[model samples]
Target: MEKYIQEDLDKKIILLTGPRQTGKTTLSKMLNPDYDYFNFDNPDDRLGLQEKSWDRSKKLVIFNELHKLKNWKSWLKGVYDTEGIPPSILVTGSAKLDTYRKVGDSLAGRFFQFRLHPLDLKEIHNFLNPGNLEAELDKLLFSGGFPEPFLNGTTRFYNRWKKSHLDIILKQDLIDLENVQQIIQIETLIQLLKHRVGSPISYASLSQDLQCSDKTVKRWLMILENMYIIFKVPPFHKNIARAIQKAPKFYFYDTGQVIGEQGIKLENTVACAIQKEIHFREDCFGETKKLFYLRNKDKKEIDFCTTSGDDPVLMVEVKWKDNSLSSNFEVFRKFFPQLKMVQVVKELKKEKTFPNGAEIRTAHNWLSTLTLP
Candidate 1:
């Protein structure tokens, strides 16, 4: 990511956004030691931005939390159009920076965006090179992929950190980004969703449980999505509009936030991993890849699917201990034989492949080497 980010910094403004503690600031600073830094949350830095008073001699200038500025897109456009890029510009934010990219034509082609996510199997394998991948997987499942908690590797620290993490995002970030007066209700919604991971969410059901209208429930879900608290995976259907109208499954950005059985956690973790992989291709290679789940009216379901444009590429089923092949694989194969199918098992004694090209693979090994077509 650093290599690709560096390459883009030379030619365009780099907009890096992600969850609150996904190491955006740390990664930005590491890119250049002598870079000038400004935070919109700081009074002094805010004043400096208003005055355009940063040192231009530095090779890199990093603007932290710049999205908080009113009319920031026009402001940045003016800066880029007039001053040009001797000192490369890198903007970092916690919220979805791309959401505001469509506000106006102010920043049409001046920036390249990158979304940073929590650590996953492939990243741990590449960077940490863990001697025991299975143990690292255990740590990721238990403490989550956040830098601090995962590194601490202690139950007590994770518990304490988890409380403060939610408080800051819900109490501080939410208040800053939105005007919703129902913080408690939003928190309750998160709890309700935690237990329903890997299942389609019915807006009617959610509204009834929260004593709110369906429209309000949908608005709250969008708010949560923009804040990077959760992501939704819609069902796979050839008709795009019809697919969107169907109920979508939700998963948390933080795996530790899930409250359910081990199988649920494993599914959520795999979802995150696939999402990260998709984002990587879109960001670095300009590929058209998306994530989805397969379900029909008959209740036959597969855990995940990846598509290139409108064509399905891969189908995956996640299991904690069951090594037996999923019957749904054969069902889907009959329809889309060109798509690769695999059953990822956490406790498989041996990996095998069927004559039809479907496979049963060990979860840790397969995930560590996961890549898109």
Candidate 2:
């Protein structure tokens, strides 16, 4: 698979991070075919690398999940400072390396972080023929983008993959990377979070339920976020202090992982597809753009807020039904008269412009147009 970060690998100490089984290792192999590979999961390999010092003269060295080790950052600093500049270094981990407690006072400003999300329309197009968007959406929503599950296309295989991935992360990754003692509590917390995907996370409530402190809950959530397991989307409120604050909506970095763990629902699927389209458009435009959801004091909400600089370029509302516009859109339209476009996905079969001058387009057509210039 073609990665968005491959071109920038050599120039920076690229930190390739994502949820388990998103193909970080595969991408690393493709990027550095001649490099020496070491995986911390392997006992011998971990010991060897830990025992010996890093030599800068080597062609390339790829460290996989080394952040699990307590001295990983210190060891890396020693290698980086002593080694020559010609040789390249690559590190891959399922969890966030920077979140590691041991990564202190070393490797500052030396690495660039890149997140690899689940298979999106852009990546699917690159891998296979960009034939029909509807069919592609069906495949992506049901089969999901994980390599093994998507390739096998069987319920049994997908179930096994989900089970094994969760077990490994809970049994191995967390234990190795974090000194997590209450394994059951963490597992329960993850399952609970999965159910509350698009809702604002309540750390205090979660802590109370888990019989832990608020700070402990926050720390665990951070660990999950850094591990690429989940992400939070902040509300877009400019000059509106009354807007919803303090809590942020949570989302899985890979919608597929969420679907596999939880059951696939139409609303969730459509939301994921729309989110993917918004992100792709931003990436293609090469502008500092962002995706946000809006909610006001009156409980009026917009599904997506796409912006360039301080200006609101577009406001998108996604729905699974056709020809449906909420009263919320009218409220939003009144707030910002200049916001002329509102996209309703899965609802409209064809692109249609409202009499009020807002252009309503199909999700597929809109996403296809987002290509790198």
Candidate 3:
């Protein structure tokens, strides 16, 4: 079960959205188990929704993949308005529905929106038992947070699951939602991005490498992000002159997709863990939290930063060994006095202090201790 599932359902309707295969459907079923669950993917459910034949008098109703319908907004509004509070409603779908559910005025203030993500370190490990931290990280890095593959726990099963997941997203979901015609180019871009993880994205360089225009490259990147295949965090803007502008470092939602190298997968794993913490704060408690990268014209960089608007709350850097703070981070701390500095590393160390007073800890300890409020 996900922490987001525990959020209070005070609104008339709740909209649950997230990347594909992140267990949105499973959670929805958990929410309204005894009620008649309607998934639009099923032909019978589609016909029922089209004809308004489903039981409206039920105490609770769950609409799965409801956003796929053309007039999902209008239909939802009609039902929500006419039915009042007798039949509580829950709407679940991929990230595709996230936009339609939030932007349209018809659904405004009517539903609470939440984004479900793949599993993270804290979800898999018992914080009380730090004894097996090494083994836990190895397993999570090898098998991504997606429930199916993570639970299977075998190389053969993981590979087969990854191929099937990508095929469905690249060949079907992208086509159905984005109406993207350059399937081959986008697919190539996604493959290339796997190598570019934990680094700043250069559209101009990618365009030249792929023999496509910069605009095309950016469009493909955006499409992949919308599909939740990847995510990007922009540079911090607290100090404009020192911070790099408009440059975002991308990370995959699932680290298992990164083929052989454990370094990038390690960084990507930490990124996802931090992302889960911040997004939960936003979706569950309505807090303004964001993740970002810190770098300046000097080329000195830190892996990740947590912020709320212009205020930098925490600065995080991921490392595989040593667990020692870098000089670049010392300079970053001197510059941003308000932000708390933390170094998350693969190797656990007795909370060591840097020359500039930064703290270092293992990824397992840092992630396991985080709470939304």
Candidate 4:
């Protein structure tokens, strides 16, 4: 398997974070072939790293899932400060290292953070064939980009893999990372969230369903988000002060995970893949681009908003089936007259420029055209 060369390899310390089974460990091994590997998942390996913190060898070091340890940040800071920077350090984890609640003021400005999302269209194209976009999209949406399940090429195998993966994350990862007293509540919250994808999350409603307080619901949601089990995309509102502010649309990190757990149609699965690709691109390349969903008081919605600085470079509406532009486009054009609008369809004949000056393009073509600026 070809490793996607990350851009920030030369930085002092690189923290690679993503949801479980996104190939973080595999990528770390490939990044530093000569590094001494230590994973907290193994009791012996964890004990070794804890006992030998002062051994300042010059060889590269790769720490896997060490963020679960309470003193990991401080320990790494001491190791790096005393070792004189000869050994490059790479830390890979399933959760966001910076989001650990017990993390102290250490290792700041000493590391560059990079998030590794599941394989996108570009990465798959580079690895496989660039021309096989439709097949790749179909395979990725159905089987997901988790290396093991996708390679296995059977729905039963993928479903079993997803169940086992979810169990480990819920049972082991959460318990190791957080100091929660009610593990069952957190597990139930996660299961409930799978049904709320693409819907605005209400804290009060969630709290009521879980028989917990609003604050507890919020905290647990943050924990789940930090662990990359789920994430929220805020709505785009510039000048509209009265626009809805408290609610955010939620999505799982991987669409296949959601599909395997809940049954989503092929069309909805495709939409989720496209959404993940847009968000991943924006996050990986910051300042140059932004991705958000659009909503207004008049009950209009757009699937995605991609912008370059203040100017809206593109406004996109995704539909599973062939549908005409909703009146919402007219309202949006009234506000941002200069921005280009587009409609992305799962099934379309190439790209078409509508008579109303909007572009109608296949999702695969549009995603392939996007490049980091």
Which structure among the candidates has the greatest lDDT? 1
Q: Which pairs clash in the backbone of model 2?
A: 321-347
Candidate 4's residue-wise lDDT over 1-373, tens digit each? 2232344554567788888988988878776566788888888888888796523463567788978877888877877677645566878899988887365557877776777777666666666665678776677777667777876768899888888988788788878888566878987887787677666788899999999898999899888888887776667777546434457766776667553332243333534455555555544544455556777777687766667776666677766556565566778888778767877676765667876688777766665554422
Please count the clashing residue pairs in each candidate, in the order shown.
0, 1, 0, 0
TM-score to true structure, per model: 0.98, 0.83, 0.91, 0.86
Task: Write candidate 1's Cα lDDT for 54-105 as tens digits.
Answer: 9999989999988778778888988999999979999999888867553545
* Candidate 3 local lDDT, 1-373, one digit each (tens): 3444444443558888777888888887676555667888889998888887778666567888787677688789888788665566878877546554433447777777778888776876653353676676787799888888877789999899888888888887777667778888887887888888887888888999899898888888877877788888888876667454366788888888875467778888988988888878887777899888887778998888888855777888878776557667877877788677777777665768665558788777777675422
CA-lDDT, candidates in order: 0.90, 0.67, 0.76, 0.70
Over 4 Å off in model 4, which ranges? Answer: 1-10, 53-59, 101-103, 239-244, 259-289, 355-357
What is the lDDT ranking, best to worst? 1, 3, 4, 2
The number of clashing residue pairs in model 1 is 0
Clashing pairs in 3: none
Residue 45, candidate 3: C-alpha displacement in angstroms: 1.0
* Candidate 4 or 1, higher TM-score: 1
The best candidate by TM-score is 1
Q: After superposition, how far is residue 349 of candidate 3 from its true place, in Å?
A: 5.0
Better of 2 and 3 by lDDT: 3
Residues forming the 10-long window of minimal summed lDDT in candidate 2: 259-268
**Alpha-carbon RMSD, each predicted model:** 1.2, 3.8, 2.8, 3.4
